[model samples]
Target chain A: MILINGQPENRIPVSDRGLQYGDGLFETLAFRNGELELLEQHIMRLQRGCKRINLSFQHVDSLRAELAMLCAQTAEDSVIKIILTRGSGGRGYKAPLENEAIRIISSHSMPEYPEANQSGVTVRLCEQRLGLNPTLAGLKHLNRLEQVLARSEWDDRTISEGLMLNINENLIEGTMSNLFIVKNQQLLTPALTQAGIAGIMRSKVMEIADSMSIACHEKALTVNDLLDADEVFLTNSIIKLWPVKTLLHNDTNTHWQHGALTQQIQNALKDLAH
Target chain B: MILINGQPENRIPVSDRGLQYGDGLFETLAFRNGELELLEQHIMRLQRGCKRINLSFQHVDSLRAELAMLCAQTAEDSVIKIILTRGSGGRGYKAPLENEAIRIISSHSMPEYPEANQSGVTVRLCEQRLGLNPTLAGLKHLNRLEQVLARSEWDDRTISEGLMLNINENLIEGTMSNLFIVKNQQLLTPALTQAGIAGIMRSKVMEIADSMSIACHEKALTVNDLLDADEVFLTNSIIKLWPVKTLLHNDTNTHWQHGALTQQIQNALKDLAH
Candidate 1:
């Protein structure tokens, strides 16, 4: 069931700027064990996304309560999506004077995670490169044509995910996840100065590194660095963290076995969520 | 009034991927004398946009009939916006199953062409830059956060448009329109190899240039080229073409009188539309 203004309704106006200009933001999370996992982080990111797009970040509590009620009704492991748009903006780029209310939607089923999570999942380099825009960087806004294009590069379900590089050939992140590498025990991630949605799992992973006395840095990395890394893993709120077993570049493959620290970080997220 | 599936309905399903992952395409056209200006070109672009996004262009009859009716119902001059979305995919990036009917939304309103088309509009340089993604470039897809951010940079209605540069500091296009420049009787527009939308009016002007014996070339242009241009103008279907009288670049001013060729092209669009 869909929740509109804290009530169950399946209809959103076609004139929604979200559907028009992609003038909106969204949050997808793992609603498991009767709780909205990482609820605070999701709301924070949603607020920042709204601010980035010049939407008013208001009445978040009303939406948050609705999310709890929706999750309360679910029966099994599920993926819950929360979309907050500028509602129905006028027929132009200029935002409407009166914004539409936030839309809160919940679903009750999620696809099974790859069995190779322990053995490391396979990944490919995407042909579609992302553009650098620091202003919109780090916010999980709804203008996701780049990710959709990147994800559609191939239909191979075998490939766990795809790595996207920016126009400058700098490795950004996976289609829907952040990329992290371990080199000589120094955890390194690509900087978000250019593009890529800085994932919430990424933020938590960085924090875990800080607390666990692990060396972590958010710096720009190229395809070469990732090729030479001792270990690589992808992170997102939905998946938490999954190791990469192989890299598929230009249809060729390179091996990356699941490393020891991969499980440690997954446990780290589970600890925080529970 | 709104048209969804040839009937009046304000509500679209919440699961529409156009609102989910921006899995959609759109076209905006000018209406004059009850005819859609460059209607075929608009449809061709929409078709191309759907192809790039892997959306099977469907329901052409209903969308076309509704658009025609809306345009006909309007006064002598109007604006038409047609939206085609991937029709309610479940909350994920995956393309929905085949046989999902296309959702077409058409809206109409009076054109916003300013009274002082000859006086030229003041243009400002937007701080936000366009991201380069050739896969989605030139197609008027729904992923438009950059344009929304750039348009948000200014609230002054007097500023006719905002100029957007790419991350590499190359001038791409305006927030909502394609850009054109004239230097030494030579017309140059940015080649949409990486970023920016290939607008219908911009394409029409190129045709008018070819017919009018004006030298028009699409190539990579930088901010320096714009600063040194003999004339500058922004093109979109509703506005046709608007010359720039003054440019506010990083708070500095550069003025150029409206050139004869710019006016000639604008006049051509007006004559062709009416």
Candidate 2:
């Protein structure tokens, strides 16, 4: 069974560009407590990401409604994915000259966070560095081969996640999540102005940091910065916040355990589930 | 009408990781006068690409038949695309512990290359450089937001394409097509061991050059090589060969122009297309 546009259906034109060039945006949000985890934030990111790609924003509200309806069906915790593509035509990169309705695809699946949250994951730095494209950075658009490749780097059950850097060898985010490092009690993440997605979870953490008076800054972070930091952790809507028990800095055999700050942030993020 | 194992279908499951994580491989081929243009070469590249991503090859034969059927449906000349995504369910990047099926999606559309072929195109070198991930570099995997941003750089109809480079400053390929530079008398393209797709059109050009006893070398390319080149051109199956009338070298006032070598390679590539 499928829910396409608030109705049960099974057909979308094969020419939809999302199926073509992945010319679209997607939000993989958590659905719990009978509500979308961050519906508005996902919508805003979808809108912002659409503008970044020059895709028309028509029918977005209807699509959002469709997503809400689909998520409402499960009644239990699930991972809801919302995909909005330029809806098929106008040849390659050109958005259809006429206004094209964005195709909406909302799917639900059992959430996979409880296990990771129970036992902090062993994270490693991936060799595949995210490119510093300030323009396309921060939005979780459809182009995800890099994440797939980075995630494919290891199948070892022990390694939970991988960190990615930009071309300048600056630590960025993970294959799927955003990265945060605490150095001298200051919260820092690699500036998304160059690369990396400004994930909703990362944004939430920044807001929380401000509320608590923690100095949070977005700046360039290198392997050295992360290696020498007081603490390191990763965040995504699904993962919430994960304290890194291990880090594979590109240079040496040096590794560190989850620091006090990682614990603090992880605790704060966990409370949001309640 | 459609064909997947010779049956019409559209759905590939909501949990299909390819749709979820862009975890799949794809090929866009031109079908002219009833022939699956570059059939063997395209399939070989797809096979090599699939292997790199670790997707199963079991359904490849039936998938090939499906493509042939899809292409046959296009009585008139058209562009054909076949996407082979690792079908469904896996937690994060780890491939599902259980065996997985491959989802094959094929679609057809008319070629959109007339304007580009008639009047040569002006291209801007995109600020969004392609990420250099050796693991996913040469494969035409689903993660393609980089190209989307590069292609979105221009809205003017006259500017046909954009040139992309790796973060290390090595010239990669056009947002959609592979690039070729003719300097003095040799043919050159940036090697794709680290970035860019090894386009079937590129392979054909190399064959044509060898047959004509023209030296075609794949090596590292830089802005300096392009700025000093005698002729510059871009190629893909759709736009057979497009000469670079002018190229925007970043934000600089510098531009590349049409040249003799560009014309020769254009004609040479056209000859091989028949």
Clashing residue pairs for model 2 = A138-A196, A138-A197, A138-A198, A144-B143, A145-B143
Candidate 1 error regions (>4 Å): A97-101, A114-116, A250-252, B97-103, B250-252
Question: How many backbone clashes are present in model 1?
Answer: 1
Best by lDDT: 1
Which CAPRI category fits model 2?
acceptable
Q: Write the per-residue lDDT of candidate 1 for residues A165-256, one digit (tens) a residue.
A: 98889999998899999888879999997788888889899999999999899998999999999899999877888888899886678887
List fnat per candidate, in order. 0.80, 0.44
Q: Candidate 1 vs. truth: CA RMSD?
A: 2.3
Instruction: Please report how far candidate 2 places residue B232 from its true position, in Å.
Output: 3.0
| Real interface contacts reproduced by model 2, as a fraction | 0.44
| Residues A32-90, model 2: lDDT tens digits | 67767767887888888877777787777788677767766777787777777667666
